[model samples]
Target: GRLVEWGGTRQIIKEPRQEYTNALVSVHEIEHQEQKPGTTPFLSVKNITAAYGRSHVKVLKNVSVDIYPGQTLAVVGESGSGKSTLARAITGLLPPEEGTVTFDGRPLANRLADRPKEDLRQLQMIYQMADVAMNPRQTVGTIIGRPLEFYFGLRGRQRDARVAELLDKIEMGKGFIDRYPAELSGGQKQRVCIARSLAAKPKLIICDEVTSALDPLVANGILKLLLELQKEENVAYLFITHDLATVKSIADSIAVMYRGEVVRYGAKSQVLAPPFDAYTDLLLSSVPEMEIGWLEKAIKGRRMASAGN
Candidate 1:
């Protein structure tokens, strides 16, 4: 593919001189009001350091972040930047070599199996691939109802009722109850995954690139649904993504990670405002704008900065 134009996303959309690029950037944008963070963070990951088993290499370097109740704290970075590793650490999939994860005023166990049943129930996770996350043999009802049954011991009609309610909550309605994963669209399957997480009535949901795999329109719908659910359920989110656009749409706070280190962290407005850290600036500048000579201009500016330095 030929590179035509590149700069910030808004610039790319509004000022594209290339017809090809203009056509590409034309899509609906999601508007979100930045929410204020509460005084107390319900989930605190303090100075976490982790590494793979049998390896001396540290993948996470003193990383830490606080997620307020009912808000979204997005951990953003490109691949191999420890975004997912941080998620793994918090979920106890990979226990940290150092530091602590505190939830709801109590310290959490370092490993998933060691955590109490209540801890597992209250801290839920939604992975990127909805298709693989659910079992193909299970009906949508069964997938969503399993959590309700597991967490609250709801069975039979009660579980089914709760499943239908959750389906409604995800805006999928109750019609999908009988469908299998293979029968559903990508977005629909993700919605079902979301409903399953909500079925547990979690206080915090770790959304690891939940919208990155879907079409833009479909992803926006999911983001809207998530925002709506957060409002209604008051469930906080640790939203992990590499997409800055997605971060702008949903994050109340942000933690910018690079090579296992948190380079920047704060409220959405502060973190995104001017005087950005080097990596954050690079990430923001790479958003691909629609200007006629935006790419050339950006390149020139970067070169000039490099020369001056």
Candidate 2:
């Protein structure tokens, strides 16, 4: 309910003054070295404005961000903040009423259907729900191989071979190749979804809340695997999530969204550093700390801020 102390994970875990924080001795922060933005961006969304239906309500207001090759840009926001809408705009699922999307230095078509096959091949999406994302009736091999066959025309033994290789990459050995999605665990299912996207050999992947569904341990493993895959494949990621912990784990850069607008955007170190914007500060303060009386402190802080306003 409140944060008693904030410091390096090892320091807090080994020397917890608060009894509540003592229970978290076993927890460890994910090891990540935040990187600065590179000179060139692989995907650029410039001054985008989008709306839905006839309401004329702009879901995204002049949103813009740059994603570099082989890096992760984690978009953090509460629900209804337009983070996912930004993804939709980049993916061309919801064409932006204003602004342009440029990928690999080429301007992208406004609609997904209008994009060239090469454009389609280089951009992929891994959704949040692995269960619904895969066909219940399809075998694991078939599920993964469909993209290989569709994009590369691999067939028969060749497709099977590639599917097995992908399975190995996801750290699921070849034995699970013939099993159905119903038989796999949640993490395994998401790993399969990752393999499916990897099969496309994409330059950029839009991961929409990909880990929010799993247990903490399982989600940590997924994050580690994604980082490993990113290293080996040189693929950029647009990682959207509301979890600050997850953002700290995987992001090289970040964009903090609020009410259809980007309130903060920068390298991870810059965005997560001190002197936070009001919304970002509130979001950080709202994360439940392991320290005793954290909730009370948070409540009091909010009340004081409310009074000031």
The most accurate candidate by TM-score is 2
Each prediction's whole-model lDDT (CA): 0.90, 0.92
Residue 28 in model 2: lDDT? 30
Q: Which sections of candidate 2 miss by over 4 Å? A: 1-28
**List of clashing residue pairs for candidate 1:** 7-288, 7-289, 11-290, 12-289, 12-290, 16-290
* Model 1 per-residue lDDT tens digits across residues 4-97: 7778766766787888665456533667788888888899999999998696589999998999988999999989999999999999999999
**Every model's TM-score:** 0.90, 0.91
**Alpha carbon lDDT of residue 297, candidate 2?**
96
lDDT for 287 (candidate 1) = 72
Model 2 agreement with the true structure over 185-273: per-residue lDDT tens digits: 99999999999999999999999999989977688889989999999999999999999888988999999999999999999989999
Consecutive 10-residue window with the lowest summed lDDT within model 2: 19-28
Q: Pick the candidate with the highest lDDT.
A: 2
